[model samples]
Target: MKNWLRTTLVTLFGFSLLSGLLAGCSRDHHADWSADDVAKVRDRIAGKMDLDAAQTQKLDALIAQLQVLRSDIKGTSNDPRAGFATLITGDTFDRNGAQKLLDEKTSALQQDGPQVITALADFYDSLNPDQQRKLRQKLERHKSWFGH
Candidate 1:
């Protein structure tokens, strides 16, 4: 009985350690979009596309530009729950407050939109025909997820 109990405890402890290690290995958290996260994305896409150095460099530039734009847009955002609560704190829906939030978001988009477009265009144009086709296919496969 003593030996059996010891064996069971050992097995359970080993499994628990393995499960913890495996859980830690998965680094694909989607919440925070930091520079490191964007670089990982660039690395993954670059691998998938088999990008040459020049194309990879363009991709890097595009990814960098996107990170900057994301930071800029995110800077304009506050806690959504708090913002919405403020809007509804009064008896009436604060249309003006809501409009102000919308305008801020829109302004951020307008400010960063052109630079993003340019970077995207430069990266896409740098791709050869085969790479472009692969990119289009990948986008098509994922487009439905975006409600397109």
Candidate 2:
């Protein structure tokens, strides 16, 4: 019994130490993206597309537009579950209330969608045939959620 307890205790300690080390290695995803990180990603994308000066400018504009849209969407909701809770509180499902909640959420998207679309269009139109082909190839290579 003493030998068994000693081995169990040693194994538990080993696991705890290993878990701590692994947690230290893991990234803090909650941290916001820094400007340098954004720039590096932009530069990498620009390099991949072989963007000219004007094309690079357009890409930057698109990135800015996307960031704005992201901010707008993120700012719209503090707790998504809170909105749904109201709709389900009554005995019957409140269709009107649900619709209102959806509309409220979608309002931000509706407002910002046009700008995102325009920026995307401008960027795509700026790309030459080779660059467009490369972009399409890269997109096609991306795995879907179903792993196609």
- Considering every candidate listed, which one attains the maximal TM-score? 1
Model 1 lDDT at residue 80: 31
List, residue by residue over 22-140, the lDDT tens digit for candidate 1.
44533334547666877788889999999999999988888777767766655644443455457768988799998986687688889988988998999999999999999899888
In order, what lDDT does every prediction score? 0.76, 0.79
lDDT value, candidate 1, whole model: 0.76
Clashes of each: 0, 0
How far in Å is the alpha carbon of 36 misplaced in model 1? Answer: 3.4
Model 2: per-residue Cα lDDT over 8-99, one tens digit each: 99988996796566455333352378878889999999998899999989988998998887676556555534555676589887899979
TM-scores, each model vs. reference: 0.70, 0.65
Check candidate 1 and list the clashing pairs: none
Point to the candidate with the largest lDDT. 2
C-alpha RMSD between model 1 and the true structure: 14.6
